[model samples]
Target: MRVVVIIPSRYGSSRFDGKPLAPICGRPMVQWVYQRASQSSRVETVHVATDDERIRAAVKAFGGNVMMTASTCRSGTDRVAEAAERLGLGMRDVVVNIQGDQPLVDPRCFNAVVKPFTEDPSVKMSTLAFAIVDEREITDPKDVKVTFDENGDALYFSRATIPMGRDGFSGYTIYKHLGVYAYTREFLECFRSLSPGRLEEIEKLEQLRAMEHGHRIRVVVTPYDSPEVDLPVDIRRIEEKMAAMGIG
Candidate 1:
């Protein structure tokens, strides 16, 4: 099965406009994400899906592949689906959606996300989750939490702490959801056709739509932490991380 990585980028953002173009260590944030994704040994192709001319130009300037999507895409997933359709990918192929803001995303995580599909044919969708090291992050709305079944299938995703910690946060492992996702081309088309679910609307987490529709989302536990750039202030933090990692 072919594994394609699609990074959805837009120049407009309520928090940080033109975020994809923001420079980090002399490269645009989108380039950093694209470069890291390109290092994934499992990925056959990496493309930046965007509607903005500036973003397209930047991706081209870096000699990266890019596809123009409609500006009216409801979500990043929608943009990815559009790009995959335009590319004429087969239904059995895997399409990975990597967030453009994640400049420091681990390339190995790409391999991990696609493992479920290789090991089990039943896995139509898969995502990564990390053990919450900081207790404070459990309550933070910005950091989404996920609860999985005994089989490692996601039960629910929420902005609030899940499982309620009825025992006072002991004997339970809380997982923080990572933004990375891999979906079969068939399932991705099905996903876009489904209307928003009530739980998804309430939590504002789109992944819940699949669960609400009775589709199982395999949750892969990853040790890597995804540092996303949400605002301008986050640039320094990412740059510091790059410096510590000896990245030029």
Candidate 2:
């Protein structure tokens, strides 16, 4: 089955307005995401799925594919699902959801998340997680944390520091959940039909809806940590990282 990468973007955001088109190193943020996602060895195609015409135009101007989705779409996953349908993807095809905010995402992360389905035909959903090297991320709500079972299936993803020590916090390896996700087109349709869970609403995390419905999410640990842009202030930091990594 083919692997498709869809970057869902919106013009309006509570924190940062017009985030997808925001300039980072003189290029729209979505361009960086699209270009990096295209670099994936396993990805067959990449598309920007959004309801806003501005995003569509920007993507097209950069010679990238764009699909217009409904503005009423509930989440990025919903947008990706609609785009997948438009692309005529089959149930067994792999669909990778990469957020536009992650301009510096590593191409290898895309391959890593899609690897599970390649190894096991039964695998439906998978995501990337990076172990916390920065202590601040453990308590930062913006950086979602996750804990997985011995088999690498996610146990729970939360904004709070999980497995809190009764004595003191030390030597705990917290894993930060990356926004990148891969799903079988069949499971994506199932995900769209599933009702939102209480925990999902509380955490504001859509992945919880799958867990609440007894779906197993395989977590792939990647050495690369992709920093997401949540505000205008984060732009400088991204540019700095870009320079340090020798990325134009």
Candidate 3:
């Protein structure tokens, strides 16, 4: 039942290079994420998993724990699985995967994502979801939408509008998939081993791989919204949001 937070970082980004090291409110984005994640009362430890030495150095410079994974890792999940193996986490230990790009992730989101594991031993993986309040996000490809079953298990995660109204129906709520995720160390290892699924490759949503493999991911609805830094301009937006929230 140890909860370990791992942030998969990379120095290169097609949209914004050195994204993990990018400064936000006078601190590197990764540092902000690490510090916030550490604030979670449920988290036992936090580690920055990166293939780049500069990101490793940056995390180390900030007195944060970091581990180097194989550069060949194609996604955050792969890097986290490797980091989990290196850290020697037990099979049942809960591994929280917090994306480095989300500097303003609420510490409470960590607890929300990890709660399912404690309540249900069969829950091997879980993720946060928020009911979309902003109207524009419903059709925005950048905002991934998720549909869940009555039991809160994810039915689908997509970039396109889900529960599409063929006849202009608009009564349903669309949930935005928050980047935060949690997995048992064993399932994480299994996730990394499985080949990418067709829907995962098509939608470019890695979470779909689990569903395609018949794995039911519990969707934890959370009130907190964690925005990501996709381009250089997003830093200022995050800073503004942080400042408005009185958060550094």
Candidate 4:
């Protein structure tokens, strides 16, 4: 099965417009995401899926592959699904959806998400979650939380602090959901057919829709923390982090 990485980018954003073209340390943010995803040994090819001509041109100018998707696509995942359909990938082929906003995503995280499929052919969908080491993140609504079953399948995902910690926090760990995901082409099609769930609508998390529909989402614990650029102010912090890591 071939492993293809698709980064869904749009020029429009309520918080930061034209975010894909925003420069960070000389290179556009989307370029950084594309370059980092290309470093993964498991990914066969990386493509940027965008509806905007500016984003397509920027990606092409950087010598990266670009796929034009429909502007009506609601979310990044929808754009990825359309792109995968256009590519005519096999049902078993793996598709990794890496968010364009996450410029600090670790290359190893890609390998981690793909491992579940390699080990078990029955695994249809998988995602990455990191241990919540920072206490501030536990209360931060921006840091989405996930709780999985003993089998490592995600039970629920929410923006609020889960498991309530009412009994005092000990022996349990709170995991912050990362924006990366991996799925088979078949599952992607299945996901598209499902309607939004009540919990998903309440939490505003798309992943919850899959869980609400009784689909199993394997949660892979990753050590790396991927900070996404949601606002224009986040660029400076990402640039500083990149510089500290000796990345240009």
Candidate 5:
């Protein structure tokens, strides 16, 4: 099956306005994300799905493929679904939804998210999760926690800490959810048709809709932590990290 990476970028963001156009070094933030996604060997094609003409123009200026989606789309996943349909993607093709705000996302993370489906055809969708090493993060509502079964298929995802082990249960793991997602074209269409779930509404995580509907989400853990840019102060940290890694 052919794999395509679709990055959904909207100019308006509640926390950081015009985030996709934000400058990271010499290029816009979206460019960095597009470049990184393109580096993934598993992804056969990359497309940026955006509502703003400015974002479309910027992507085109960089010689990146872009699809103009309807502004009414509520979420990035929805935008990707529209793009996939517009592009005439087949049911067997895999669509990787790469977040536009994550400029530092490694190509390997994209690979990790999609690798499982190749091994098991039953894996309809998947995402990345990292262990929360910091104790402070365990209690942070902003950090979405996840727990999976022995087979590495996700059982649940919540903004609240999961597997609330009692009586000093130390060995149990706490994982923070990563925004990246890889889904078959068929599942994405199905996802758009389904209504939001209870835990999803409470946690405000759209992915939960999959779990609520009995769809299994395979979890892949990544070594590198991709910090999302939410505020202006985060730019310095991303710049520092990029500089340290010799990435311009």
Candidate 6:
């Protein structure tokens, strides 16, 4: 089971421009992501997929593998699929799509995501989910929620809180959907062939496309909590965490 981790990074960002190149501590954000992915024992190779020449050069400067993708890619999944085709990923190989902004992503999360493929040969797509610790996250539209079946396969993913509790609903479990995904080459080809579903358009979640096409997506639960950098103020929180951890 050879696994390749692809970090999709683009220079243009609406919230924080040049986010991939932003310096975290002494290194670029993407560099941190790449380094973390490389630590995964299950991952055979790590590649940074980007559209900007500056990002490509930066990855190269750090002696990291990088691939140039087209600017027209609508999402990170699309970018990774293009890279998989460009790199000639065989049908049997597994490709893990890792988020570029999550500089502090847990290596264990990557390992857990790819583990399902090893257990079940039929599993084509997989992702990670974390139990929400705060009640505020349950109602926050930005924090996507996911519900799974008895087999731990995802039934639905939505921006709104699912399994609506009764009037006095208390202690109801909630899970926050992580953006990381693992896809087999055959699933990637099938994913590209489907049209975006109405639910996906309504929620702006690309994973819904797979469910719409009747494909089962295995859900893996991870105990690690990742702090994402989405706004300018987020840099301060990450810096403070790094300082406390002595990561430089």
Each prediction's RMSD over C-alphas, in Å, is 1.0, 0.9, 1.1, 1.1, 1.5, 1.3
Q: Identify the superior model by lDDT, candidate 5 or candidate 6.
A: 5
lDDT of 6 at 212: 88
Query: Higher-TM-score candidate among 4 and 6?
Result: 4
> Model 3 over residues 34-63: C-alpha lDDT tens digits?
999999999999999998999988989999
Write the residue-wise lDDT of candidate 4 on 50-125 in tens digits.
Answer: 9999999999999999999999998888999999988889999999998889999999999999999998878999
Regarding TM-score, does 3 or 5 come out ahead?
3
lDDT at 237, model 4? 95
Q: How far off is model 4, as Cα RMSD?
A: 1.1
User: How well does candidate 3 score on lDDT at residue 58?
Assistant: 90
Report, for all candidates in order, the number of backbone clashes.
0, 0, 0, 0, 0, 0
Q: Write the per-residue lDDT of candidate 1 for residues 1-248, one digit (tens) a residue.
A: 99999999989989999999999999999999999999999999999999999999999999999999998999999999999999999999999998899999999999999999999999999999999998998888999999999889998999999878667888988899999999999999999999999999999999999999999999999999887899999999999999999994
Give the alpha carbon lDDT tens digit for every residue of 40-150 in model 6. 889999999999999999999999999899999988888999999888989878999988888888888889999999999999999999998978888988889999999
Q: Lowest summed lDDT over 10 consecutive residues: which window, candidate 2?
A: 163-172
Tens digit per residue, CA lDDT, model 5, 52-141: 999999999999999889999988889999999998989978999988888999999988999998999898899999987877778888
The ten-residue window of minimal lDDT in model 1 covers 163-172
For model 5, the stretches where C-alpha displacement exceeds 4 angstroms are 167-172
Decoy 1 TM-score against native:
0.97
Residue 151's lDDT in candidate 4: 81
- The local distance difference test score of each candidate is 0.95, 0.94, 0.93, 0.93, 0.90, 0.90
Q: Across residues 1-248, which tens digit of lDDT does each residue of candidate 2 receive?
A: 99999999999998999999999999999999999999999999999999999999999999999989998998899999999999999999999998999999999999999999989877899999998899888789888999999989999999998767776567667799999999999999999999999999999999999999999999999999999999999999999999999997
Q: Model 2, which residues run further than 4 Å from truth?
A: none
lDDT at 129, model 5:
95
Q: Which candidate would rank higher by TM-score, 3 or 6?
A: 3
Task: Give the candidate number with the greatest lDDT.
Answer: 1
